[model samples]
Target chain A: MLIKKGAEANLYLKEWHGRKVILKHRIPKKYRLKIIDEQIRQYRTLHEPQLMHKAKQAGVPTPTIFMVDTANTTIIMEYIEGKQVKLILNELTKKERISLCKKIGRLIGKLHRNGIIHGDLTTSNMILTPTGKIFFLDFGLGEFSKELEAMGVDLHLMKRALQSTHFKFADECFKAVLNGYMETFGQETEKVLEKIREIERRGRYIAERKEKP
Target chain B: MEYCLGIESTADDFSVGIASFEGEILANIIDAFISETGGIHPREAAQHHSQVAGKVLAEAFKKAKIKPKEIKVVAFSQGPGLGPCLRTGATVARALASYLGVPLVGVNHCVAHIEIGKLITGAKDPVTLYVSGGNTIVSAFDAGRYRVFGETLDIAVGNCLDVFARTAGLRQREGMPFGAIIEKLAEKGSRFVPLPYSVKGMDLSFSGLLTAAIELLKREEYSLEDIAFSLQETVFAMLTEVTERALAHTEKKEVLLTGGVAANKRLQEMLRRIAEEHNARFCVVPKQYALDNGAMIAWTGVLAYKHGQTVPIERSFVKLRWRLDEVDVPWVKE
Candidate 1:
């Protein structure tokens, strides 16, 4: 077992007779009330992964579950050995980047069509397995929402991440992503996107004003 | 078993991860745009993600050593982030999953980071400080969600660092994003121009600090580095205060510092001091996990999987305005 220690949980790389799996165990604290801590741990242990599963059923990409151990606050399942999408993008050509982004946009549009909001959307949470596949992970914060405000924030976060990381070709890259999104969302999603932009602009303006005084 | 593979493109770079039960990181590919000689150009970022997202995912599966038949789920970042970038990641995850006879799960990137931290550190109830370009806040695991106890009413700490990094003429793409160069300059130039320090109970404000720094720069009132130094200090201090408060409020003993800005040694040190003072331990994922990577997503995927949670293919879609509070918690484990 390969144990990875976190602040609140203990993760173990559990392997069984030629089988490989990872186990995350949320350890208890000696300082807190057992009831409260257990409640939090229990809720998270069940709530998060279920959200991931629900997102999967909704057509968003996530991982499959195998076992849940609330007593030890551990989750055990398959372990994929691959690279992150961030690294994969680094290796792609410019033209390839555009084509791929458009496809991504359409996928996001589909998510909105299904009313699934991925609360925290950033590139860091994505994966690019070697065989031309994309996966979404971490639905601990996933939720169901018909409200555009939530969706607006979701898209806004993506734009912000792009601008921050792809400082050079952010605009073009975003355009392609938008292309993909529009493909599935239809033109009606434009208004929602526009509103998101306004919110983002407001945020940028606030930050911009602070930079100078 | 239903599997949900996660693809994150909500930013310049593209990333993908497969989350089974505990999450086996299949791919963590990243593509950065080297500006000829400028700072973050939004238009450019969008184009880049648009271009490379597909190849990245292809590579992700390859790295995982898995075939499409071996997978059962596809997860993509929905939103609560940049639209274009989010769309790029979301759209790709959506399309491929649709073709694979797999279910799609839309993930929140912010929560992904935190969940990864949780997966890596196992911090079940630790306070989370999500310091990033678009967000700056002190968060806590509460009521089945990571609640925002304190956040910037204006700009985010990472964004603040990025703007100064640009103005300071630091290397935009390659270096430590912006915090490193800016913070280093901040070290020598010690003339402190009192920046805005707003901490109204749990809420904080970073715009005021950025504004002060901008004014000083425009006025040429002091050396740029000095102003940068002050800003970093003031902003980091603001974050430390709020984090400390969250710890206190939640009575949580540990602090998990995730996000791009978490890479800053100075910020880490300052936060460590606060944690030490409070007798709370602090956990900051290594740079790979800290800045942004599929490992975090894959790691968080493990937790999500165990709950018997799965998103339907046709119903699955991207959310431009996803919020942490909106996700429903259903635990089959307990």
Candidate 2:
């Protein structure tokens, strides 16, 4: 059965070796040249599964890659049965939400510590399983970037995601997330957080400059 | 019905418009300072605005069949634009408001785009994709304000296209800017040259893509039409992706496209398909209002006037960096 049809890929439910799985196929875009489209789909399909594995190794939960059909640009991964955190984040009690934020923070810290950047770090990319474990999904845009700039952009993206979708508790939730991040990386996280501030400052400066008549 | 006059001198366009409180546009007169060269020169554009200010005002008054004394309020674009250009418009607006003994409203150019878009297309509470030579932002109204969900991290999409056109020796088509010149050629090209597609989460950066496209021209690696095609496809795809994400996040029922760049057929097609995929109504303002014009300012000014959102003369100075989200839209509901 077809599940979700995203801009980059389509999600389908299928059975793989007697186990429920999600078949994520990167759809070929008609607007792109066929060869370039094929290359991009192939590259992303190959990289996403590898990133998922690395993320799992770094103490974050990710779907098990059952199989990868590079020819078709498809990945059959273990079906994760859970609610997207964005859908239920507001429903959670304040304390539970803060705890979830901390979990998110630590997971991000682990990813950053391993020099992996989740390109799309929104709450929608997170799944809350039955056991309350947080699983990061959709590493399609993820890459190995050890640069503090990339790490800062990642945290900044997450912070912005909270501010946009969860503005009510964004400040507190981001604080909790930072608390967890600082706890995991300690002093090392300081520079990355400072990078975020620099990024914000840069944005402010640009906006200010553009504002000048 | 009370009428408001809106003066827009945000960039190269000096326009004056009159509208009723109920959103009826009476006059929308504009005098654009088209640059013969690649890009606009700020001081020259300002001088052009100052020169055409009187004639445009007279034409607007004549078209609207109303004298200056009949206008109840005067609104001018406060900012997110060029400084000298904004100052020229502000000076004209403040003098008119003072002469006519009317209230003044300092309108955010970005918010005015959204507001006029809503007024024209009848899209209530849309996730707005405001793209132009100056801005690339995805916004939605929430919590009594239009919150920016995503924006360009560097140069705007239109600027990227304009610069590419200039480097490629493309000529501006009648009624279309240099970017549209690229779009017209792109329609015939079947090949897509590979260009950088930069999307940082919800935000995007186009300088890399712009540089890559220009470099491709220097390399002589691809046909001009092919490169143009590729650039439009890649850049519009980035915009469409960010807009789709904002739509999903906001779950808004409507999508509105505004700004000068929204006139591109490919962009409209891309955004319309995404809006359809999400089961949201898609709306684009008529081309006249879509591009920078006085009517949007006039209509938005009416909205502000109804809510007592006017600015005092002393504090009505132009704000070059006024953020759309910073404006409290009292007229809009939660």
Candidate 3:
């Protein structure tokens, strides 16, 4: 059965070797030319699994890839049975939410340290297991980059997602996340944080230039 | 019936539009400043606007067959545009409102584009992809405002195309823009030259792609037709991807394409296909309404006026960098 429909792909729940697995199929977009669509889907399909494994090696918990069908642009991975962090964030107590956000931050720090940028870092792309472990999901937009700009953009996306989705406690959550990130990522965290501020200033500069009247 | 007069001088076009309080557009007159040599110079465009302001306003009144006294509200494009151009339009609007003793409504240019599209296409609620030479934004109504989901990080998509076309020795005709010309060339293109494709989450960057396409043209390794084709495919695909992402996020029932770039058939086709895939209705504003015009401002002004949103003459200053999301669209309900 199709569990979810995304912009670039669709997710299906199926039994693989008597174990439940998610078959992520990067469906061809009819809007794009056939050549372009195929190239993008094939590239992303091959790229995501490699990044997922690298992230796993970096000590971040992620779903194990069971099989890869590049011909069909599909990947069968371990199906995670847990609530999305987005859905459970508001329900958690203050202490629990802070701790959870810190864990998320540490995971992201590890990923960045390993030169893996989670392009989309929203809470919806994270899952909290019943045993109190957080697993990052959806590496479709991820990339391997050591550039400070890329890392900054990844964190900025996380900040924006939190502001839009969890507006009430965004400030507190982000602060805790940064604190945990600094602990794991070490001295480089300062530079990455500065780059985030620069990115933000750049965005505002486009809008605030008119204030010079 | 009450009427509103709108003045548009946000860019090269200095247009005047008269619309009824009931959403009927009576007359829309536009006088554009076309630079033969290069891109628009802000000061020159503003001078042209000031010189033609009287003639366009007079023509608008004649076409509408309504006297200036009939207008109950005066509105103008209070920007996200050229500073000098916005000042020219705002001055005219202020003078008219004060002379007629009518309320002045300042409309956001980006919001005007979306509102006009919705008004004409009859889209109740939509995720809008508004692309123009000056802007490329994907936005939707949420939490009392139109939230920008994605936009160009560097240069706009239309500006990128225009720059590439000019570099390829393409001339801008009276009716056909550089984009249309590029589209025509792309249809006959057979080869695909890979260019830089940058998409950071929801945002996009086209400067690298533009730079790469121009460099390829200089090298003469690929035919112009092929380069044009590749550029369109890559850029339009990127745009379609971001729009689709916004659609997936918002899950709106309709997708509305507006702004100057909405006239491109390739863009419309791509957007239509994506909307169909998502089971959402796709609507494109007609050519007359798609391009920057005074009608959009007038119609948006009416919407604002009815909701008791008006600006005082003293504080009717133009905003050259006004963001779409910064404006409060009280007229739209969830």
Predicted model with the maximum TM-score: 3
Docking class of 3: medium
Candidate 1 CAPRI level: incorrect
Docking class of 2: acceptable
Off by over 4 Å in 2: A29-37, A201-213, B170-174
Which 10-residue span in candidate 1 chain A carries the lowest summed lDDT? A204-213
Candidate 3: RMSD over Cα atoms?
Answer: 2.2
What is the per-residue lDDT of model 3 for residues A126-193, given as tens digits with 9 covering 90 to 100? 99999988999888888999999999989988876776667678888998889888878989898999
**How many clashes (backbone atoms < 3 Å, residues ≥3 apart in a chain or on different chains) does model 1 have?**
189
True contacts kept of 1: 0.04
True contacts kept of each: 0.04, 0.24, 0.46
lDDT of 2 at A22: 97
Reference-based lDDT, residue B41, model 1: 61
Model 2 chain B: which ten-residue window has the lowest total lDDT? B170-179
The residue pairs found clashing in candidate 3 are none
Q: Judging by DockQ, tell me the better candidate of 1 and 2.
A: 2
What TM-score does structure 2 among the candidates reach?
A: 0.92
Predicted complex 2: DockQ:
0.37
Write the residue-wise lDDT of candidate 1 on A1-213 in tens digits: 655444345657777457787677766643322444466567668876776676667666666777887777778755656665555554678898887667666667877778777654545557655665556754444567778866776776566555433535667878888888888888778787776755544553233322332
Q: What is the lDDT, from 0 to 100, of the residue A47 in candidate 1? A: 72
Considering only chain B, report the TM-score of each candidate against the true chain B: 0.90, 0.98, 0.98
* Global lDDT of model 2: 0.87
The candidate with the higher lDDT, 1 or 3, is 3
